[model samples]
Target: MPANLTPQYHKAEEVYKQAKTSEEKIAALEEMLRAMPKHKGTDHLQADLKRRIAKLREEESRPKSKKAAFDPFRVEKGGAGQVLLLGAPNAGKSAIVARLTSAPTQPTPFPFATQGPIPGMMAHEDVQVQLVDLPPITPDYFPSGMLGLVKSADGALLVADLSSDLVLDDLETILAKVSEGRVRLFDPAVQTAGAPADSDEVLLVRIPALLLANKGDADGAQDRLELLRELYQGRFDPLVISAETQEGLDRLPGAVFGMLKRIRIYSKEPGKPVDRSSPFVLKEGDTVLDLAARIHRDFPEHLKQARVWGSARFEGQAVQRDYVLRDRDVVELQVDL
Candidate 1:
C-alpha cells in the first residue's frame, strides 16, 4: 500500500485483527469502507470486501431482523469535479441526468422517488464533472446528513418549476438549508449566470449556483419566470428550460466547467506541464513554491528559484517561486535539479 493509504490499512487491520466470528468480521469490513480510499486502484479490493461483508451480515440477520432494506444506491464518486443537483419533487433532475451522462436512471413522476444520490458525468472539453441528483427535499423530509453533502459540493444546480407557485416555497426552504455556497438563478438565454450587474451584494460564498426553471414548454412558464426573476431581484440569471425535451443540455456542461477554475502552467523542467490534473487543484495567485510544498515537503525546502516560460510575465522570465503565479504561468524550478 502507498504511504497515503497506510492510515486506512492500519485502521482496517486493527478492526479485523481481533474479530473472532463472521459477524465481527462484517463489522470490521464496514469500518474499512468508511476508511478506505475510493479510487480506481482500490476498486477490486473494495468490491471483494463489500461482498464478504454483505454475505456475513446476511447470515447474521434473519429476514425479520434485517433492517438493511439495503440502500443499494451507494454514492459513487465520478469525474474530478462534482456538481450536486438539488430541488423539490418533479424538478426534472432525472431527465437532466439521463440527457447528460450514460448513466441509467428511472425517470418518473413522484416526490422523493430517488431514494438516494444518483451520480452521472459529462465532459466539458478535457475536463469532466460528475453531477449527482439527490433525493428531492421537501419540508417534510429534509434530512440533516443529506444537506451536508450539498454544502461540500463543488457547485450546485437548484431546479425549480417555472409554471407553478410551489417553486417559490421550495426556493425559500432550500435557501434556509444551505450552510455554504451562494444561490443565483440561471438564465434561459445564457448558461452561466452572473450576479446582477446592478446590485453590489457580494455573494456569501463564491461557490457557483445554477437556478433552473424547468418545464419551459408548459403554460404560464414565461409569467412564472418573470415573477421568479422579480422575486430574486434579478440577482441571479434564471434559466427557463425543458429537461423533458433535453433543451439547453449541451450548454449544461459548459456552464459547470465555466464555474470551475483551472489553468495549466509548465513546470521549471523541460517537457513538464505542472500536471494540473494532479490530486491537488490550485487557484490563481498560488505560488509554484506552494505547489512544491504540496507535492512533497523536501521539494519546498530544497527549492532555490524558478524560471518561467509562459504568459505570466512574458516568455522565459526567471523568477522566485514566492512570486505568486498567475493562471497559465509556466514555472521551471531551479531546485535540487
Candidate 2:
C-alpha cells in the first residue's frame, strides 16, 4: 500500500529535519501526525511517529548531568508570560530590558555584548512578565535554536536602533529570518479577527509583537522614525522610546501585559478581604469555573456559584459558574464541601 502524504506533512517533515532540540522535533512530529492521511497505508508511519514522540518525551524527562553541556538558548518560562527581546547587534535590546526590569546589562560600546539569553522580570502592575534579552541576531549571527525559543514565547519585542543609519537593513534581515522559520509577527490587533485557515504550506506560530524604535531621544531619531514608517509603510507603526532617557515608557508595561491577553483576578474568601497584592492571572475570557479549578484541582467538581465584585451587576452579586471574568474582578468561590 502506498502512503500518500499531504503537503502539510511534507512541510512538517522539513521542519523536523531542521530541528535541533527535542522540543522542536516533538512539535514538528505532532504537526506531521495531525496532517497525515488517516489510512491503513500510513499505519506503519503512525506507529513510528508515536514511538519517536515517546522517546523524545522520555529524553526530556531524564535528569541532566551537573557537568552536562549548557544550552544558552533554553530559557524556562517564568512569571505571567515570557516575552523575547530580539534585535540586531547594538540595537539597544539589553538597555531597554535593563530599564524595564532593573536587571544588570553590562553595556559595551560594541556589538554582541550579550552572549546568551538573559532573563529578567518586568513588573506589570501586580504581575511580573518575563522579558528575555536574547543574543543579538544578524544575517551573520543567528544562533542555533533561536527560532524554537521564539516559537515557544508568549510574545516578542523587536527593538530597532534609531541612532544607527543601517537600522532598516538590520530590521529587514531580522524579519526575513523569522519568516523563514514560519513565525509570523502580528501587531496584536491583526490576526485576532480569525486565525488563518489551516493550510498545507502554512503552519506559522502567530505571535503578538510590538516594534520599539529605540533612542528616541537621540539626534535625528525623529527623522529615522519617519523613514521607518515610510519604509515599512503601514506594516509597522513602531513605538518610539528612549531607553536612556526613559521617555514614552510609562505605558510600556501595560502594553506588554495587553499583548498577553491576560487578566489579573483577585480571589477572595466569603467574609475575608480580597488580597490585592497577589492576583491569580487568568486568560482574559476565562470563567468563574476556570478560577475555581485554578484554585484547586477538585474545585470544579464542588463548584456551586461565585460572588463577583468588579464586573457584577451589583456589588457581591451571585453569579453562575459560567460567568466570564474581567481584569481585577474579585471572585469569591462557593464550592460545596
On TM-score, the candidate that comes out on top is 2
| Candidate 1 TM-score versus the reference | 0.63
lDDT tens digits, residue span 228-331, model 1: 88887644667667888767777778776655554444454645556444334454445666667646667866887677666556776767655666555656
Candidate 2 off by > 4 Å? 1-69, 190-194
Best by lDDT: 2
Query: What is the TM-score of each predicted model, taking all chains together?
Result: 0.63, 0.79
lDDT of 2 by residue, 232-296 (tens): 65466688988889987777899889988999999888889898989998877667876886788
TM-score of 2: 0.79
Q: List per-prediction Cα lDDT, in the order shown.
A: 0.63, 0.82
Candidate 1 Cα errors over 4 Å, as ranges: 1-80, 179-207, 264-268, 271-280, 293-297, 326-330
Q: What is candidate 2's CA lDDT for residue 98?
A: 86
Measured on C-alpha atoms, candidate 2 has an lDDT of 0.82
Worst 10 residues of 1 by lDDT: 196-205
